[model samples]
Target: MEKKTNAEVQVNMHEEMRRAFSLLSGKWKLEIMWLLNQRLYRFGELRKEIPGITQHMLTAQLRELEADGLVLRTVFAEVPPRVEYEITQKARGLGPTMEALTAWWSEYGQSVPEKPSMRGRKAKAASSKLG
Candidate 1:
């Protein structure tokens, strides 16, 4: 096997991280996935559940998520067509990550007094660092 340089290994790691994050990159992608993880939501229901998300933005985000295979969009045949959204198995795979974030936030984030303070952030990061 060929020996890879440190820079090459770092680049590979960054690429992997980028590709992984890209699937969930967006203001509402994670939130949408988290909500859908619980139950199927019709389009309007989703819009109402998430505050400040416009209809156009929700549609666009849902389309992007569906394209990424993280969300499933189902349309029912009826007098009035109904569309529902839910998280896919691929997205359910992220449940552990979501839970980890929730746990971490519940423990550390709530303690932060206010926003725009790096003192608390740096202290927390240093304390949380593990070898």
Candidate 2:
């Protein structure tokens, strides 16, 4: 094998990481993966768990995940034809990464104050004016 330059190696690494991220790109894919990582869920159950995702969007995201090796979709032969989704072993490999993200978020969240609610601000103003 021919030796590669440092710059060429860095570019290859960057492209590999980009390709990995591209597989998981989308507003809802990560969210869906997180939920599926925990347990199996049917189409309706997944829709209910992930708020703000429409039926069309859920279907599309699931399809994309299934296309990738990260998610597994199973269909059962039954009266109603049940279908369920679960994360593949490949996705489970991301557990450590997810834990690291959670840790980072926990540490980062402590320093940043949450935004005050608009309703609370309005109520405070009204009370001050009345007093």
Candidate 3:
């Protein structure tokens, strides 16, 4: 049996952690990655799923992930044309890590109160006063 030397193990561990952080350390990368994990989505579909993400930001983020070799972008030729994005094998490998994070979120998400939405509150108040 062969064993990894201490230095080799440390280097491997450091690289793995660095890769994880590089892929996930961003405002929308994790969110986008998780969504992509579910299934490939067209540009518009992704935009709809991630509310509050402007088109410009989403496009920029997707381009960055594509450049990092974590995402696959496919374009189809048609009358209107079609484009889709999906996680590459490298990104899909993060499935377990993402799933664990998702599990943690499910367990604690409900206990956390989301920020108040002024637009939502105002609409509710207006409707109540009208009725």
Candidate 4:
């Protein structure tokens, strides 16, 4: 068997990164995962925990997470159906990575310059046009 070239290894790594991002992308997926990591939550509970997320969006994000094998959804058989969401073992494995990112963000975020506001940029552009 031939050893993989550096270019081939880089390409493979890039593809894997893309796949990882696809699973974790979107505004609420990471937040939802963070919450679920703490403990199991019902659909309504999750919605309440994540302020400003619509029920439709929460459901959609949970479904995507479930499909990705990072989250497990359990439905209980009873008079009133009880559904709960929990992070899977695969997702639990990401705990260390998440912790490292949080630590890095605390240090890195302070060093980064604040982004200029879009409204400020637009006002500057308008003033320049008027001049």
Candidate scoring better on lDDT of 2 and 3: 3
Between candidates 1 and 4, the TM-score winner: 1
Clashing pairs in 2: none
Give per-model CA RMSD.
13.8, 8.5, 6.5, 9.8
- What TM-score against the true fold does each predicted structure earn? 0.75, 0.75, 0.73, 0.73
- 30-58, model 3: which lDDT tens digit per residue? 88999999899999999888767778888
- Candidate 3: pairs in clash: none
- Clash pairs for candidate 4: none
Where does the lowest 10-residue lDDT sum fall in candidate 1? 117-126
Error of 2 at 81 (Å): 1.5
Each prediction's whole-model lDDT (CA)? 0.84, 0.84, 0.84, 0.86
Q: How are the candidates ranked when ordered by TM-score, highest leading?
A: 1, 2, 3, 4
Off by over 4 Å in 4: 1-11, 105-131
**Candidate 3 Cα misplacement greater than 4 A, ranges:** 1-16, 116-131
Over all chains combined, what TM-score does candidate 4 have?
0.73
Winner on lDDT between 2 and 4 is: 4
**TM-score: the better of candidates 2 and 3:** 2
**What's the lDDT for candidate 1?**
0.84
